[model samples]
Target chain A: MLDAKGLMVFYENMLALNNVNILCKENQIVGVFGANSAGKSTLMYTLSGIMEDIKKKEEMAGGERITVSGKIQYKGIDITKLRPSERARRGLILCPERRRIFKESSVLENLRIGGYLASPAQANKTLDYVFKLFPALVKLKKRVGGFLSGGEQQMLAIGRALMAQPKLLLLDEPLLGLSPLMQAILIRATKVIRDEQQISILVTEQYARPVLPIVDHAFILENGAAVMEGSRDELLNNPDVRGAYFGV
Target chain B: MEILIYGTINSIALALMALGFALVYGISRIPNFAHGAIYVVAGFITWTFLKVVGLGYFLSALIAILVTGILGALIYRFMLIRVRGMAISEIIASYAIGLAILEGLRWGGFKGMTYTLPVFIAGSVTLGGVPVDIHRLLLIGIGVAVIALLWLFTHYTRIGLALRGMAQDERAALMLGIDSDRMALLATAFGSMLAGLAAIVLLPLGNIVVEAGYNVLILAIAVCIVGGLGSWMGAVLAAFLIGFAQILTVVYLGSHYQMVVALLAIIFTLIMRPSGLFGRQKELEERV
Candidate 1:
């Protein structure tokens, strides 16, 4: 469903993403495993066209000189130069790192805001699906987003993205700062969403063990480079992968 | 009794004047320094349509509001779009636009005390033994109605919800397909119309002079600064505070001190709390 080739992102003199390639087939969950500063978020930003926005903002502020070179194709259409909002309209939604929820809005309002591109019926249906997928949110419908726990916030973030009716959902570090139990729940839900909605997902994580069981294809990123690529079992069987990511 | 009635009316008027500035700032982080120019221009447009063009009052007012909205959209599209994300540039460009518009109108001969709008109703009623004009009473009603309508619009409508989302977090809203540029344009247009509304409602009580533009700008800035830059509720509360203070000054220290009250409120708020009363920026700073 999505293909990105030869993606290179530079921040001044430092390279954030170096000659990397990633793909997500229809109805597939692709895992990107990397440590801190591994270019995972940069990859997500590049794919979702947020890099263009960041580049423009940085340029306007006269801050960093960010350079991004890449070709991104979604559903066989080149979308490298599309704005983030345009990409989102075409169903490329990113649930960004840190669960950037509208802190002042209530959970229900957050979901409503997420339904910006959706029709009334589509929004209502997706909203119902989101609440069903994250049933815990049903109880906290009126609670403000900032007051929610980290786990609840992550759930809300995913639910909010689902409200956008994404064809390809990019989950950037969904497991960060989450409890093991919450991570397990989120991983399981991620798989169920793919099965139920037929939506492709690209999830990035530092630890791959909890997510490995669900991802069909996995890539390991090291220092902005794609070091390894294989199917789930192919990665799980490797001693180095198991030792470094699986903590075995 | 006179003080109470006049204070309430004056407070509502101040709230109306500042609402547009506060809203544009809140949604797009654009200060919209052209707010006062829009107000004066809308009043002039309505007067032109009414007297020179011989149109009816309602039609002229409606046309003026629409024209002002388009003017605002044009300002954003042509001028403000490039300087966006740069705070100083946004302010300077908008203020420059405001200065040009006000000065242009003055040069174009939209001066003197002869330009005055007719009140919607021409009667006075006794309120607590004080004679209050129907227009002032109508202004209060319109002010309350505008606030209520704005609340309902933001809370219930799809576009309004998207706007609120953008106001809270621009990038997150973008991730959900809410176009920030479109929302900002809509905000600028709506805010200009709000300024127009204030002009149409309040100008009937006095003449439409070019100098009123500068006074309106200063007053709007003072109220917005005192109320916390982007909070509507804060603007309303601060308006009442400063409104009452201005009324009391006019009653005791002479009417000339009315403008002084607004300037003093701005200064005091800046000195006491730079963030104003309900500022979220300060909380975010504290968190960091």
Candidate 2:
């Protein structure tokens, strides 16, 4: 299980996330829906330790400029202050929104490099599984990553993350700019990965409609706050959420 | 025929000099302007060692190379790393070091005297009816041999491959868990050693002075710009091209304008081919 409680984040002096709490059960797909500039990227970057500004509610300093803060517990261990690579070692992997792929390198080479922070023996075992999960990537393994289409790049990104044998994969805005066909492919693939690998996934998305059915639970964020969080069915049925977020 | 043979030897020597700086730039991503100081320092130090301490020529050269390596490492870890990512600042830093080193060498030990080295060989070689100093010819041979070895190292060795990877993309290299600092130290040592070797060889043929590197430094930098960073093959080719051009210029227009032509060629190459003739193509890889 993953739990984040009483988390506060500040950058300089401004608050991005304030006193937020979350719980994700093992092997579950959790989604966070938010508008642009709603502090989604900051939240994800904080979780990954790339942007380090955590705060306890007691320590909040009229906070408005700081980034991510809060207790993020994974498997009962507090990972709030862990280094990014240390987090990866403990199976808290991030597919980073832009998918930092090494261009001029082949798809397989990029994947192998991503697995660098892992043990070679384990990475090799997981490499076969990653290929099986994203067979499209397997065919393009020898091709340079820079030449891949957006969808293919996204597949390679997630495939690289999975190559690390992640227990909880944090994806930031996975479907933000992808085409409808690509979005569908990603959703279907993400579902299969969760079920087959028994890995938990927390994906952020701007369009909730497409992401609604696949995820078990969700939190709707607006203006840097989690307005509501519940089972997917509840969020689907809520009139306020539908009117405000889904534009129903 | 006389001009052609002399020009070839001169070109090869200048090419070897440029390789010294190119090696450091290719690995560390810092345009090391202070490398001229290495050439001048090694030359002066070797002259002093063999003349004052009565050491053999080769032994003095070895000592100078070892000292230069230590200095190179010190400059890297203490100075270059501290001010990297600020290109303008780094340029200023290297120039300051160069100016300080040049001036320091003048006052402290050399005392503005024109120091001459014992000739490595007395005879001249008559090649194609052109008589050239045998020692100068020997320096040209050594330059080619060193360039060949450097080529083999980059194309085949593990550390050389890592240096290339770092030069192309430092962040990506780090993502691969390569400790770039260690690689950098090794590169500085290797580059300084090569430069020192060139200095030791060239010192015997030319007058040794505190500011000895000024002429050769410009030649080397031009070679690097023309060769392209991160490309050893490019360096070798550019070195020869610039070298021969310098000699030919001296033959036709005299040595007074040799540097002017090299600079003009460098500027022309910069405008015409920013990546140089053999430079690696920039990969527009997305990094978001």
Candidate 3:
């Protein structure tokens, strides 16, 4: 239900995202696999409209000139120039890399803050859903966000995004810096969220093995370009993809 | 007994004055240098309503606080929005606004001891052989209530929680659909209303003169700086520290040396700690 075409982003003379096109259908989980500096995070930032804010700040400070050109259609509406908050209001929320949870705030307060735009009934319902999805968070409701472990913080970040009631959740490197077991648990929860809540997910990761099981379609990005796109089986069957990404 | 009674009263007053400045800085990272100007303007507005418009004290005070809040929001929306990210520009612009307001009021003949708000209560009562006015007791009561109410607001309310999130990590808050500009505007408004509230309660003890505006601004800055820039608890504790110190100076040395106490506290804090009593930035720096 989301289509982005001909998306190009440049920081001065350097291209950060080069004519990238990505899509996610309704009730689908899409995976983007890449190495460091592969423009995966850049692509996610471009989609979520945070690039607009960074561009404004850079221009105001007379720093690097950021040029972005794209046509993003979500549910048949073009939202290329929308502000980040406006994009979020349309149910496109980003759970950013590094899990930028509010450190001083308690877990419950972080979730409550995420429900800023939700009605009381909706927030309450989603809060219950989030707690259920991440049972580890139930016991740490009163704990400060900074004190939580990296795995717990990732769960809280995803749960906080869910509190916003996203139709399409953009997860940028959710598995970064987490143990293998934590990655497995998050992958399982991601599939569960898609299955039970009918929310579309676009998740990016450096390693594909843990995340590939849940993704219906996958895209391989290299040097700011999308090199390949296919169903999970198509990607898995490719010997080159197996050697480079899947480690099969 | 006299020193103890007056010191508590003085400390609470300092806390009330610094609370608004601390709040705006804490939430939005805007120093809001116009806080003192807003305090004076609220006093003038209350005076106009009470005397010229013939409104009662409570009604006038309420309306004045509301007007100052809207004034603060408009300032952020129209003026400060242009210079949002630059720290130096924010300070210069807000201080310029404060200068214009304070000087503008002076130019408009709002001078002298003519403007004074009537105390909420009249006369005095003896406490342990030290007589304190009823109005000062009411000030202490209101100050405690304001702090309690503020604590509850930040902990339990929706917008308040969002503000706390914004204060901690603004980009993360924005990603969660909490509008940053809207939250900053709300913070400015709430902070200005707090300054107005402080003025309504504190200005009644003496004439509302233009000089008090500058003095209040300096004192607020001193409290914020000495307490650590954006820490709420730091500001309160610093206020008590400075307030008691000021009272002690007035008692032992001389009343004229009272302002020196606040200035000296600021200098000592900067030299000894640099981050004040509880600066989070210093901790972050140390970690890095």
**DockQ of all candidate complexes:** 0.69, 0.13, 0.63
Off by over 4 Å in 1: B281-288
lDDT of candidate 2 over B1-288, digit per residue (tens): 766677667777777788878888877766777888888888877888898999998899889999988888887888876666556777788778877888887777674556888777789877777777789888878888888888777644546655655665554444334446666777877887888888888878768876566777788888888888656678878877876787788888888987787799789989999877666546354232
- Give me candidate 3's TM-score against the actual structure: 0.98
Q: Mind giving the per-residue lDDT tens digits that candidate 1 earns over B6-71?
A: 999999999989988988998999999999999999999999999999999999999999999999
Order the numbered candidates by DockQ, best leading.
1, 3, 2
TM-score of 2: 0.71
| TM-score preference between candidates 1 and 3, better one | 1
Candidate 1: the clashing residue pairs are none
A15-82 per-residue lDDT for model 1 (tens digits): 99999999899999999999999999999999998888889999999989999998999999999988
Candidate 3 lDDT, B33-83, residue by residue in tens: 999999999999999999999999999999999999999999999988888
Off by over 4 Å in 3: B281-288
Better of 1 and 3 by lDDT: 1
**Model 2: per-residue lDDT, tens digit, A52-137?**
32232123333344455568888999888875656667777777776656565578776766665556787787788778877788
CA error at residue A19 for candidate 2, angstroms? 4.6
**Which is superior by DockQ, 1 or 2?**
1
**lDDT score, residue A220, model 3?**
91
Docking class of 2: incorrect
> Once model 1 is optimally superposed onto the true structure by TM-score, how far is the C-alpha of residue A191 displaced, in angstroms?
1.1
